[model samples]
Target: MDKATVVRKVILFSALAATVYVSIGTSDEAPVQVKIPTSETIQRPAVSVPGTMQVAEELGAESDGSDPFEPRNWVPAPPPPEPVKEVVAPPPIAPLTIPEGPPALPFQFMGRLKDGTDEVVYLGRGDQPVVARAGEVLESTYKVISITPTQIEFEHLPTKQRQVLSMQSN
Candidate 1:
């Protein structure tokens, strides 16, 4: 009807509904000595196996039950190595009789050819001309063109024709 009387009625109705709801929510009876979670002592098993309830005894595990990471129980180890051997070598040797020098320039020193048939050194000092080997000096093939005896003039060695040797310049 009037604005002041309407506002007073709405306030009284809201207060009565609030009291009823709070009383109904707390009406269930719990015991006087109730347990809260933090104040209780929990029960736990001291030793634990990984997957099952029983202990791990099948693989020779000792049940002193210390830290699982410690290596107090492991398999045995192997033995040590053997020593090496040393080698022994042989001694050196000596030779037989001592060897001689190269044979004397492979030549017999034959004397002059036209001196009234004188000795040929290759013919063992006999009558005829003898054949010459490669490095040997022949008397006829090499000539003293003029002789003063201090140094005889020479046209020396290796004649294809007996007159035409002229191997040396001087």
Candidate 2:
């Protein structure tokens, strides 16, 4: 009746047509149909049942001894129990916070002591030589976040990458 229904019918007919085309294209011989006769000994003649037959069956088939309807012979069904629903509790909520930093100093500098993020503590890189070894204790201006006898580590706040700057200490 509608355009959409017509389009759907067209698509269905196209698919069937494609299938038939493929089948016909691949066939080599012509198809034929043959009807065979059946061999039955006693052919029971059809008889019209009385209008009251159904009523008689429902009334009482067992009392008459002859059961025109199927004898129930049905076993008793098992008792069914009510379904139980599970009660799920909601999950607990908590605040997100980074763990405290370690107590160890970032470098072995020894000029001034300061706190960082209430976790990291920094020592001043005061008058220390531009070059300071890992075990070497030196004074610093506290301006340098990272410096070493061999190199300095430069870390951008957002990028979070530490770039190594070689020390060209004179």
Candidate 3:
């Protein structure tokens, strides 16, 4: 509708018409030919470079006389570094000493009796009644060390470990 829009449409139509005319136009001349040489037609340079021959000779001299393509001539890759052996120290040895002690006294303190010079103590094991006195070994396993009103002390004969039993009423 505007003058600028009309002018732009006319220019676009002219460009499209020119492109179509050129695409459909008949040409009198033939298409130009381009030649790409094959491997047999390719030519190498006539002149040899100065340092190339010396470089080739040096490369040949440094070889170990083994074929480059031979699998047997290739060096094995150093056995993969021997897998980096980790030295693990053994666990610390515990000190060797006596580890066993006397087992728990199976007696329950029943009561005590003041038997003139030596005080006697009554101990019960399970349902059996046992009587003990000071310095007397009972059952060949325990020695009655001392007896008190509230507690009694006994020594295990095997280990010489002293243990006390309290005389408490339940």
Candidate 4:
């Protein structure tokens, strides 16, 4: 064999011999003794047999007429109550309609005068005196429809709604 292999083998055998020699030299002392317990010799905790027997008797009294071990005598639980459905009201079918009309007249009647064949009415707008004849449009929003001695008729230019102004004598 090679020199290195012989050296390795010699080292391995010397380590094994040393281990065996140490194990044998250490056996000169007495062996340690350990006691193992058995189930028969072990002490068991005490229980109250009267209380357990009384509980078992009460359970037996509360049992139903069906036998627990018999599968045919078992009763299936009733199905859970159906979930409550929320009622929701529908939206309105048609929207509400708002009445359409013109605003109130802002003029006050003062008096009337004869303007040749056509008559002219005097009206008061705040502190201003407005003279208007039949078929004339005043303030670009109101058109004079007719003029009379006691009352005057006017039409709202934008909404085409008729309005009247009465004469007030003091």
Candidate 5:
């Protein structure tokens, strides 16, 4: 035979021989015999461990239908404390008089302006600014005596006390 025909016949023979070997090797054998014990044949010890028995009793495992894992048997924790009330403090009391010296002036000198021939000075007491010329009375107590570019003079009407405020430069 030629070389190619001889190689094909050898490969076909090898495949057939491998198939037969695997089939025989995998054939079923006799089933194994297993013995199962009956309740009458199986035996348990007459006594259990003392500690295990005590634990089981405490967990209610021996009761007729009680289950230790049930939520109904557990006690709920107390409700959270009531929310605290906010405390409000009272307003402070004002003093009757100054302990020493004259009372402080609330006016702040802003700037000066010239209206006609008379000079006008602006003073801030709180939020509103006051416009004053020479001899203008303010708050029924402070009398404007003179107005200058750098300063303005005032006299307390009741006590005749003179006070001067200089312009604040910015």
Candidate 6:
């Protein structure tokens, strides 16, 4: 064998022999015994305070036969709060009406167009013509609910009233 291989084998054998010698030496010796005296025999007084057992016995006698720790001993829930009387709500009052004539918006419906993708409507507010699709809000208060080729529907935001504009024949 090479000089390096021989040296490595010698080192490995020596380490193994040392480990076996340590294990065998330790096994032959007795383990250290520590005598820590625990207070196992020290008796505790049966009752720490006088008359404590008597008071407990008296209390137990006052209780019903049911175990205090048992679920059955819990006080029955107060008869489910007298079924809250269904309060009859008062009848609804008529909605407030605008004394002024028919509510008018500054804008006027100009025309409507229906493409395969969406239905759009044209509204003329003053000089500007606004194109609105379904669900678009116009002039803040008016919301275009739906638009068709001939007619369009708008919902007044505040009053929730629906108004229809139809195509007028020339």
Ranking the candidates on lDDT from highest down gives: 4, 3, 5, 6, 2, 1
Candidate 6 regions exceeding 4 Å error are 1-97, 100-102
Model 6 reaches what TM-score against the true structure?
A: 0.37
Model 2 misplaced stretches (Cα beyond 4 Å): 1-60, 63-81, 99-147, 156-170
In model 4, the Cα lDDT at residue 132 comes to 93
Q: What is the per-residue lDDT of model 6 for residues 1-170, given as tens digits with 9 covering 90 to 100?
A: 99999999999999999999888776866876887766995655565553544545655555444444446636766665666678999999999976643267666777767777977777788899999888888778889887766777888888888888775644
Instruction: Please report the TM-score between candidate 4 and the true structure.
Output: 0.40
Model 5 per-residue lDDT tens digits across residues 10-124: 9999999999988776768765678899999898656555565465676557854554455673678789999999999989888787454334566898777786897877778
- Model 2 scores worst on lDDT over the 10 consecutive residues at 112-121
Clashing pairs in 1: none
Taken over the whole model, the C-alpha lDDT of each candidate is 0.45, 0.50, 0.81, 0.82, 0.77, 0.74
In model 6, the clashing pairs are none
Candidate 1 Cα deviation (angstroms), residue 122: 99
Report the Cα lDDT for residue 71, model 6.
61
Itemize residue pairs with steric clashes in candidate 3: none
lDDT of 1 by residue, 107-159 (tens): 22343333343322232225554543334444544443432212223344443
Candidate 3 steric clashes: 0
For candidate 5, what is the TM-score?
A: 0.39
lDDT of 5: 0.77
Give candidate 5's error at residue 95 in angstroms. 12
Candidate 5 Cα outliers beyond 4 Å, as residue runs = 1-101
Q: Write the per-residue lDDT of candidate 4 for residues 66-112, one digit (tens) a residue.
A: 44455563678779999999989998689788668778899998888
